[model samples]
Target: INYYVITTFVFQSAIKLALFHTFWWMFSQNSHILFHEMMRKIKYARIAFGHVLFDDT
Candidate 1:
């Protein structure tokens, strides 16, 4: 029933959605590079440790 409360809620939702969209766009643009860099780090770590030192557990 309060217009101020409704307006504030809508504004916050819009801001959150905009931020998420921007982040997704940026990530999509550099996803391949990010994946490649991550893999490279993992490869080097394995080589240095002589095995997979990190585990899921």
Candidate 2:
């Protein structure tokens, strides 16, 4: 009986850890993609603004 209880606890702990790691990894990847996209957009905007300012001057 004691052995069964221990096994059950271990199994639950492992599943919890795996789920947490998977969720964290996915969140980090998503954030990284968003950051890169935002950077690209900012760069494009900066170039466009510069062109407009130069044209007006």
CA lDDT of each prediction against the hidden true structure: 0.57, 0.60
Once fitted onto the true fold, the runs of candidate 2 whose alpha carbons sit more than 4 angstroms away are 30-57
25 Cα displacement, candidate 2 (Å): 0.5
Which parts of model 1 have CA positions greater than 4 angstroms off?
Answer: 30-57
On residues 1-57, what C-alpha lDDT tens digit does candidate 2 reach at each position?
A: 575576557656655665565566557778776566556655765665466446533
lDDT of 2 at 20: 67
Clashes of 1: 0
Show pairs that collide, candidate 1: none
TM-score of 1: 0.50
Candidate 1 residue-wise lDDT at 2: 77
Return the top candidate by lDDT: 2
True-structure RMSD, every candidate = 15.8, 23.0
Q: Write the per-residue lDDT of candidate 1 for residues 1-57, one digit (tens) a residue.
A: 875586567656655665565566557768776666556655654463443233222
State residue 12's C-alpha deviation in candidate 2, in Å.
Answer: 0.2
Shift in Å, residue 40, candidate 2:
33
